[model samples]
Target: MTSEEEGLRFPILIGDVGGTNARFAIVDSPDSEAGEPRIVRTAEFATIDEAIAGSILRDAPVLPNSAVIAVAGPVDGDAIALTNCPWVVRPKGMFNSLGLSDVVVLNDFEAQALAVIALGVEHMEKIGGGTPETDAARVVLGPGTGLGVAGLIYSRGRWIPVPGEGGHMDIGPRSPRDFEIFPHLEPIEGRISGEQILCGRGLVSSYRAVAAADGKTPRFTTPAEITAAALECTDAVAEEALAFFVTCLGRTAGDLALVFKSQGGVFLTGGIAQKIVPALRESRFRAAFEDKAPHSQMMAGMPVYVITHPLAALAGLAAYARKPDQFGVATRGRRWRA
Candidate 1:
């Protein structure tokens, strides 16, 4: 194995860079337990380098010599600007800015995929479906500032993460109600993408569309407000919108499951899933998911779960940092060395 494949340097800086929040942790050694990550808003810093310098460097237990970062965009070239946020991340720039000898940048959901392997039953709640087949492929997706999708394949001796912009895939009206709401939902580049109905802003947009369809005004402007109203049964529009969100998530997840034939499982990560468990449990999510015709029986056996662990991405990075040989993370094009 190559030296880079052997391992990254100790005191490695691990990060999960999402569109809205960038979480960072320091793995001091192979046996070191990761502490609470230092989370800073993406809006608080113009660039990733500046965020690391301001939020992670000053208080890190020890200066890190290397890093493994997951970002919410395609991992290619040296410069990465997140798909949903404005901050740009330059790995070559991190060498002088963060004092790193090695840096590995990967798609954010790839980190989520890694976490799916490491996280145990306790960190997740099964939303529905049957047993997960051991060693089978797995899928993970979630709605935060954007919708992220990834898959995990257990190969000859290691787990490989497959990340893609599956969130941008086409979605359409499957139900009679969907016909009414789908037309009003906002679209990106003139067509409704999965992310158009699945992300944070998407929830608010869908809520507004629901209101407009019913000849009423939207009362909630944020995802949190809509979720709270749905949970409390305080607003009909919020309740319907939240339930619709759950259904869309289930359908999208099932679509991804079919894409990978992920019998291992489909994991729901991020805060939105964790917050709206009630709706997920009670909504038409399962029905919509299983409505895929002749393959419905096959999809029925695939488990769906809500990941409850807060620092899943960091946990994934630490695993990769601690034992690089265990996961076949493709760092060929993305890894940079000083």
Candidate 2:
């Protein structure tokens, strides 16, 4: 065995922390004899540190020296703040309290973006467009704890993840109903972001708007319920709501495609896309996706797929730990504890 393989013994702790829950795991090196890293228990705490403590208690031979956590929010340098949840993740302070050597905290979207580098045929469900070029830029986005957005730029035959707070971008309406709905939502205006209309709360709000448009009492429904009702074809209002949702998603996705000029394709991840694929496929999604102004046709040729693996982000964390140098990860602070 090569020294590169033999020297790989960095016991790492990795996690994908979102608004609702924090998922964690510990890996014993990249090519060491460690078995599959198991999930530590999830915590319902309000802060990242509390959640980290709970996860550590569930499974930890010892606190890890090298750790990386992907959190759902805009990572402003070392100060991380989540929009949907009440939590602030401070990497430097946590490292001191936890007695760890090194820790890297990245935007959850960034982590998901890194995870996209390791995606395979088994992890995806193709939705539309033709095959994409292998070495072109790819857009990675999804509706989750909030609408998370990121892009992967392939250069020199390697994938580089460019993370961003893209979900905070402005959202516009194309349909007349949407235009009418905009006024009632003016309170949100610039304050309201894509996450407000593209996430779970967005699904609920969309459903309510459609229902109210038909002069009916709005029925409370979860995003899952909205998707299921649409797929089952049991309610016309539900179907219409879903159609609008997909179209909006497509439009935002197209915007990202334009921003990145992603010829590699657009990859849709997160839990929400997996549950609503059928509705999305049948809706105005592809049409809206290709509705780019002058470059509409160009975008129509870009492939779009929904990632289906439940533990995809986990797999990404593993791959990143296995190849930190390959991922351009900068580990500041102390060295590995002996």
Candidate 3:
């Protein structure tokens, strides 16, 4: 490991912190997998320190001295706040209070991007497209607490993760039916961003918009309710909402693929993508994805897969801890050393 890779000690705590839940595990030694994660609802605890103390430290077999965390928001300055959740993370306070030596935080999708390079075949379910080109640029995206997007590139024989707020990009109606429902979809900053209809609450809003378009009251108020009703074929409006959600996801994925020329493949990670595998495997997603004009043929040749690993983010963090030289992960701004 180079000087830039210095400071992550043995028995490190690795976590994937999102808006709704936080999953944590311990990497005991070199080249070992992260231990089974302890997942807890974010709202159940007031802060990250409290959550870790209550859920992980209390029952841990071995205490971790350092930590590498992936949070669902920008990691800058002394304090990092989650984009969707209310918790604020102060690395110095955490290491001090928990008796740790160091801490590193990353954008949630950046960890997902690293997970793509670390994960094997057993952890992935292919959705569409042809063979993935080895060592080529790729995209990793997920719709969960929010629509997260990141890119992965291979340069200087190292895998680098590029994380950003690609979820907030503008999305407009493409079809006659979309024209009807999109107008009803809620907007932030006076226009519809992808997160307006991609995340959990965003999906609920989409369902409501679908109902509003037809001048009918929505039967489902939550994403779970709408997804359950759609999967069971219990409600036509719910089904339509699911279709809209997946189609938009595919469109956005395709757009990113175009921008990055992601021939290495496009990976979908997060609870939502894993839960909706059946819907995503259907024709709607691939159809919208391959609908890119003039570049339809190019889009058809790129592969897309859904990550099936339950604790994928921790796996990524552990892999980097085990071999920091292998991945060109940017940890400078987020890393803290005592």
Candidate 4:
């Protein structure tokens, strides 16, 4: 049957599952918008099923017939494992245990990519560069519990979400300061992937590395503490570390833009990006993003934006669940038939 003919059965459960928290909401019908998402701490539940049972099912107006869960990991095969969380999501098992008709799983960034088209100007803060090119490829990426990367391409009059483990790629130092700080991070991160210096744990690593490089002891032990110190200008090392982090993030974002030829834009999302907006504006983020020689002019014209919406992934999931074919996506999640 056509996806429209097989329209999403309501009430449908939609969730943006991350390492730290899971946000869920319910939509009454295919045409209706999803309700405000309720957030549940990932640490509160032993398994994803328990989390779902405690939040969406308990408070939802009615038990959902189907669900779309966007997770912070690769969605391949029947068993989906989260990268920074202990939750292992078995779709078939969830279908049986929850008595759902079907379950759809998506990489968190893939969900973010889908959200881009639905986002309004109020939902996004433009960082730099020119206006986005119509129908061109766009990239969405950011750092939170972990780094995420995804590409959105317009093909055949539809947007296609390209999901992959792009954050695990090796990060190379491009500046003198970056080169000087690289050795200290090498000991902690081994190979120095993008996630090594761009995530929550990576923030602490950056702070420690910056402190050690300057022959000082690190006072902050957590990413939050470091960000707080940096924002308040109470710690020089923390401030420098945060600056360095933004520069690296911009550099990596620029690389991804080139990789995908994302003239449409490069969107930044995730908790960390929102928290560090002031810092990003003050840092060398824009300069770093447009530092590609030979193509520096080309890079200069690519717009960058930071998505501010809290439950963007859920909106994307809702959209996909309602009309999968419209976005050039196949609804092939594990289904339960009894």
Which candidate number would show the highest lDDT if scored against the true structure?
Answer: 3
Q: Once superposed on the true structure, which residue ranges of model 2 sit more than 4 Å away at CA?
A: 1-9, 32-43, 184-192, 329-338
Query: What's the lDDT of the predicted structure labeled candidate 1?
Result: 0.88
**Candidate with better TM-score, 3 vs 4:** 3
Model 4 vs. true fold: TM:
0.94
lDDT of 3 by residue, 1-338 (tens): 55558857899999999999999989999967788789999999999999999998999999999998899988888799999999999999986788888888898888899999889989999998999998999999999878899999999999999989898899999899999999899888898987888889888999999999999988878888999998888999999999999999999999999989999999998888998999999999999988898999999999999999987888888888788778888777788888
lDDT of 1 by residue, 11-121 (tens): 899999998999998889988866558999999898898888888788776899988999999987898889988988888988888889899899999999999987889
lDDT of 2 by residue, 3-117 (tens): 2222224677777877776777777766743234444323467567777666563457755666767878766666667777777777777766665556666667767777777
As for lDDT, the candidate ahead, 1 or 2, is 1
Which wins on TM-score, candidate 2 or candidate 3?
3
Q: What is the C-alpha RMSD of each candidate to the true structure, in Å?
A: 1.1, 3.9, 1.3, 2.0
Whole-model Cα lDDT of every candidate shown, in order: 0.88, 0.74, 0.90, 0.85
TM-score rank order: 1, 3, 4, 2
Residue 327's lDDT within candidate 1 is 92
In candidate 4, residue 192 scores what lDDT? 89
* lDDT (C-alpha) at residue 208 in model 2: 80
**Between prediction 1 and prediction 3, which has the larger TM-score?**
1
Cα RMSD for predicted model 4: 2.0
Native-vs-model 3 lDDT?
0.90
